[model samples]
Target: MLHPRITRVALGASVCVALAACGGGGGGSSTAVGGNSPPATSNAQITGKAIDGYLSGATVCFDNGQGACDLSQPTTTTDANGNYTLKVSGDATGKQIDVLVTPTTVDRSNPSGAPFTTTFTLSAIVSGATQNVTPLTTMVVAQMNAGKSQDQATQAVQNLVGSSVDPGADYIANGDSNTTGVAADMVGHLEALYGNGPVSWTLVQATMNAYAAVGNVEGVQQSDVNTQLSNMALSQPIAATAALADSLYAVDGDLIQESSTGAVVSPGLSPVRENWTLSGSTLSITQEVQSSGAWSAASPVGSYDGWFSGNFIQNTAGLGAMLMKTDGTWTNWFPNSQLHPAYALSSVGNNLVGTDPNTGDAITASYRTIDVSGQPLSTALQIDYRNPVRGSMSGTFPTGTTAYLASTQHANDQLMLTESGIGTAQSGSWSASYSPGTGVYWSSLSDPTQTLTSVQQVVGTQIQVDGPCLLLHIEAGGVAQIVESGASGCNYANEPISFPVAGSWSVYPRNPNVITISLPKSVGGATVPITDTIKNTINAGGSLVVALVNGVLLSGYMLPASSVSTVQQFPATVTDTIAAAMRAAATNIGETQNP
Candidate 1:
């Protein structure tokens, strides 16, 4: 019967711990004044600065009811000076928490030991806020890896084959007497080839061959071990086959999966198209799929497919099977295969689908009766690829505005757009379904005042909406363009005037609130106070909805639509006041590069 390959993995006992020590959790006062309210169940804050050493972007968690805190909560970034403030909301007042910080990323120079972790207890409770306590020491530092060598390659092969060759106690060369048989032979080979010297690529090949020889050499083996080996041998063939299936069927399953999951992930190589047949003690399998094209591009494509049949060995130790490769070489898919050596039958039978430790591939397999009626059987296989599913669009809308005026369909009842005129604000969202046959997001918001929201489409990053805030989407790539139709903040016809020197340039104000300013002509045109009209909108709370571009200054200001009548022009008094306000809230004019 056509069976899957088996492999095993041995986890090392070494585990590196990370530590984050914080101090200084004493009394502090906010500007606001209020009496202590009733004690409420809540989280507190731990604020401190590291005396020495730097901290990576790691999370600071509290031991809320859970024994250990997870990275699900929002974490603050540490400043350049190593100062940080972590909100420990789940812990109660007076309840001490032994907070330990762990570095999520490994420090290449040191991998064996943990960085550093410190303990701090919540000692006292302040009137209405969380209690504060001071930690013992500072000089927080991460530990370095104390030199220790591990056999990762051998362990990886074992994991892949899901078998245990019983390396015996202290699997050292010519030292341990427990090693013998297949285990001894494989060890001998490794020692002969690697002892007193560096292990070369040849040793890896020899290890693989030893693993692959398992099923062909003995009786039935475990299911888990068999699956791993089988998966490795099948990856390339699966990719080739899936590519072929897409060519013939005109289906791109990768795209379909992406759309469904709302993610742009590379799909695994499974037979996009497969056919199966079963006969006596042997089984045959074949499969194929499409190899190329964007989520929308549907024309050019390719496909591949192959066949194989093998025998199965059934017994208590486990189920074993063998298959002949396309090259006429015999490979055991179950129990053992030279492809993955270290594992044996006992470890191979644990049938579970998992990803490869080296190459993350979602492999699948299940325990099933491949044969019955006291006889053997054979089978064939095929697969087809399809497009990705579309994701749901969602966003937050400013109050007093509705999504009704927008032209887009929401997956549910929620709105995805808003208004652009006075007393209004908006944010928009839409799913990615860019295809030649389908429509793309192309709509405009017109209200004289608010700047058109800019959506950036970079080649590799996710698509994102940029303005006052940024909204990232799953689909990002290809040529990017931003254009506004109808009433806009600026006239595109008049390109941005460049200044030879890095100084200020005078231009007309968009709103009547800014008072005209006087300046001597330095570059470009002569300085003059021009009566300009701004139709921009503002958030109800009084922040500019978007930055205004005038000459070279990226000015910000709060413009109350109520301040001016629709038909009136800017007065001298309004212009002067508005300019001052813009200057007060002024930040950089923004980078010169176009989005």
Candidate 2:
């Protein structure tokens, strides 16, 4: 079991408060009035400026650390030039005290938006002496940049001043003019106070380290001078690996699957599902076969067991491996030990990219972990692309019109074909079996027919035909249900014209043996249904039938299951004879329509 790693990057700015202060104000020499007794009174004048200039009307309060500020005269406001003076008597006199200045409003022009108060300690003084308080503007701006937020930065400044680490007021005051120098100077001040004590890096180093840890060097670089400072302490490999591991664990499971579609491997091939297994440093992968719809278990199609070195996972055998960077991008040539071809990959959040080793084509995919309850059950699979053998035919109908047909067959004994150029588009379906040794083929076509009376009464349309047509219904479970009816063709001026018939079929679960098919005939945007019933045939096998009525016929044969897998192993081919026949019939229809 892998345990999550805790990185030092988790430490926040507030935690730095435990370190010493970074501001000024030290105790002075004391004079004994009566044998080491402190002075009874001390006088000090405090003055400061806002970011723009003088901070007038700002409140300055004195706390002796005992919460004893004269409330009646507890605070004094700065004048127009940001100058303020306070007279200290009582317990505050001759004792080190904290002076807090709360600005009435911050300088809106300052980018940092630091609107909090500034605090500084007043050195113990005798009567008639003055202590210059650092300007609030410089203190606030430096704190804001260090902590990256107004509130946190203000607190940091207070902590610095309270600890007596003097951040040079003059340098801070001119910070906007020479930001680089001022920032460096402020960092030096913080380092002097907290550097050797508990917090090691200066504020500058800590901020840069944080950004660099997350592959955000661009952010640090934008700060200009901090770029050089950050590079000294930047360590992303260790942190990035921990982060990547955490992300991988969140979506890890016993098995994962991804559905993909592209021409990277084969043209017009059906979609495939790729399975993956990730265990510690090892990874295994396999693909589900299209025909069987089952995963191969003998061995993984590929496997790679590696260890993370730097920002990458290199194979222990040193044949090939993958390179992963802190920015969530990767490139690899794993499992293909030859490493003749290379591929690039990126993993951002949930996206994945790669390339095929053999073809050198781009491969894109996405994945999700599968939740398994127990041994998975297998069910009947749907028909899919295997060997598509195309076929076509052309012929003249009794109604004195030409017809054309085109068809293709897939695995699982399924067939689909289309016949166009008739009054309406026509389609055909079949199940088939073929033998290359004897050049013998057997196929079945379903032809369902509608009664002429039902067509006129129920469908509310008139059709011309000499006699009844054989109606074949292909039902669920491969059952062929026949409805004895008449031929279908359009009537024009009492003359028969060949036309295509269209219909839909449905079966009820309660009585699956019975199938009901409906054909709608449209008249002036309104439709009438021609419905019929047929019984399902049971396992009708190995025989071709062509039932003719009024010079129209439907032909084909039932297919066996054993040949399905064999068909999938071969490439698709079209029957030249069948294709020629369909082309000739289409040509006839074109001649008639165009003429």
Index of the highest-lDDT prediction: 2
Candidate 1 ranges beyond 4 A from true positions: 1-44, 47-75, 81-83, 89-285, 291-364, 367-595
lDDT of each: 0.21, 0.24
Worst 10 residues of 2 by lDDT: 531-540
Model 1 over residues 1-595: C-alpha lDDT tens digits? 1101001111111011112111122112211111123344354655543211223333334323221234555345445533456665553333322233232321121223333211111111222332211111100000000011123332332332245322111222233222212232232222222112122111122223323322121111111111221222211122222222222211111121122112322333211322222222122222223233111221111111111111011010111112222232223222211112111111112232233221122222222111011100000000010001100101211122100000011111110111111111122232221111212211121222334332221112221222322211112322222212223343435322221112111222333212112111111111111100111111111122122221111112232222211001112232232223222222232211110
User: In model 2, what is the error at residue 72, expressed in angstroms?
Assistant: 10
What tens-digit string does per-residue lDDT give for candidate 2 at 207-266? Answer: 323222212211111112211222222111122122233222110011112111101222
The TM-score between candidate 2 and the true structure equals 0.20
* TM-scores of the models, in the order given: 0.17, 0.20
